[model samples]
Target: MEKLQLQLFLNIIGIGSASGLLFKENSLFLISDNSTYLYEYQIEKASLEKHALVENPAENILKKDKLDFESIALKGNNVIILGSGSTKKRNQRISYDLKTKKIENKDFSVVYERFKKEASLSDDELNIEGLIITADKSYFFQRGNAGNSANGIFILNADDSLVFKKIILPKINDVEATFTDAILVDTTIYFLAAVENTASTYLDGEILGSFLGRIKVENFELENTILISKINKFEGITLFKESDKEIEFLLCEDNDTEELKSEIYKLTINQ
Candidate 1:
């Protein structure tokens, strides 16, 4: 397959590192690392304009919080922020009111604690990166790179209760090709995998590549995995629906450089 050229979107400097994107009502919401703020961007006259939706106070939240801020999903008027920490470990699925901007702590904290305990995850293994919410279910995928544990994908019921469901692991040639980010389109699940070249154990090795794969919802089985691009450190992937025929996917890299760089790729998937 031919490589699709990605367009440069808003490169907001000093935004830490962005990890996820959500498109709602013609606006894009972003979540980033160590940020107490949620960003919203709207497209006006073919240009992207940004605004701060909410600025979380550090005193109210936990300290030593990594705030991976991996993905965002909407349920009714509530926006769910999924992330994890390193030391003083916590994997939170925080819910915030979109209109009121009120943070719901009680139920959200309970659900988050339950998931953390049920997953039996340690601080090093708790890299909660992607989330997807459906009409009756909430799905979360974690990358387990620090240990020999395989990456996990979890499902929660409509009432925010845990449901035990097993996801079929991909049989990629490389073991590090674990799931990173995900999106659900109709009945298909599209996921991103960041594969690294572990052959050389000396210097800092190059990022092998990234791939986009899809699995049918009806079967919930792994299907074809295609090489999307061979970029440097691809971290997040989100799908934006333009119309019935055209769809655009945004991919981001978590580079801690002076300029916060990311690329938006528009593609027309053959249905």
Candidate 2:
């Protein structure tokens, strides 16, 4: 496979880079797995501001470290944030409004329990990292680790009831791979997965690099793949069509360090 290079267009400092990334007009929201605050990155001013989670009774739901939110997706004003499929902390989701800045708590425990039983995944091993919701409320989730070299992608179709589907990823570089985030651009689904040599179960370790897979949404089959070797474990991905000839991407990384200095980068994908 030919490695795709990340053209470092710009790097932003601070903001306590965490798991998910979502853009709303001129503002970009980044969330930390270890914190309750949602960071708003002002593109025009190039500054970041934090917003507290006001979930009424469970006001600090996101503040607790167990939530382990790993992915964020937007369908109009409904910003859906999902936690990593930790069996101990499974089935947690938040729906936040971009315009009104309102938040609602949601549960999919029934589906999750069925998923665990069907997939035979252990309580602490459900490691979901990627989430994408279509306009009609169809859900697409990417599992970070599914074993050694193989991983799985899950889909929850909308019909008032849920229909489940799982797809496996082919081994990349003959090693284990895990996904962090995903997005759907038109008819295509693009996800960023990494092969990090971590020592802990869900903790970030010595990252060896990453892979970006391009799949078609209609057939839900892998169409193309790009090996991104220079960047660390990219925890989130969002696309922007800057022009007819090129596409722009914003990726955020989690260093898993004490200081929480998350890095941001701009990748220009030539169309």
Candidate 3:
């Protein structure tokens, strides 16, 4: 593994609890777990746009009533936003059409139930925090912060079928790290994992650290893992740029605060 360098890139104001990130063209799309709006940031102009994804009675939804949108994936002109699926109320899926600028909401409870059954997971053991969509398959990451410490992934097919794969993630500071977000780049899958000392998926814990790692898509095996930051609870990641020498990634932090500002970091990995 080569050396990695990380730096503070930008502080995005007005967005809190940013859980998922997607970078397309010159704009960056972000979704907060507690907010009903999807944020778009113009890279060149440094401007921000808020697109309401759902009608909320309150400006920020309460923790138990929030959608808990934890994963964001792009397919064609459509952006898929998924909830953590840690609770019944969090099983809603939201999709935004870039071309149409329309929002569609679907109840993913049945799909989440299928996931729990496929993995033989308990109700608290099926927290999905990351998603990766390919040409024909979609991968969902199940964060193992809740029950059984069962970190896994679900592969969804075009025919609405699923295959479950159990993954063993490395521990940070003797605490097991759970998947927070992931992005597919070429043949490898880059992921962001964080260590929070919480036994329940619905509850917040002590933020120990975060890790940047990669896994082989062919075999679903971990290739490398590196400690990125010991303080920031990074929950979302997207590919910023790639070249022959190095690859840059933009990551959003969910500091677990009421502050309306979120920090985005640039991580460069040498090839």
Provide the clashing-pair count of each candidate structure. Answer: 0, 0, 0
lDDT of 3 at 106: 98
Screening candidate 3 with a backbone cut-off below 3 angstroms (N, C-alpha, C), the clashing residue pairs are none
After superposition, which runs of candidate 3 have C-alpha atoms over 4 Å from their true positions?
none
Comparing 1 and 3 on TM-score, the stronger one: 3
Which lDDT tens digits does candidate 3 get at residues 165-207? 8888888667899999999999999999999988899899998
Candidates ranked by TM-score, best first?
Answer: 3, 2, 1
TM-score of each: 0.76, 0.85, 0.97
lDDT of 1 by residue, 1-271 (tens): 1334455555544344566767777666766654545666664533443433335433113335444466677878987877653333344556777798777542244455565577776445555567888888888776655453356676787776785344544433554665668888878888777665542211123566677777776666778676665654556676765455456677666553434444444443544
54-107 per-residue lDDT for model 2 (tens digits):
332221234334567777888777777776766555467787787798877677
How accurate locally, in lDDT, is each candidate? 0.60, 0.66, 0.89
RMSD of each: 4.8, 3.5, 1.2
lDDT of 2 at 57: 23
The whole-model C-alpha lDDT of candidate 3 against the native structure comes to 0.89
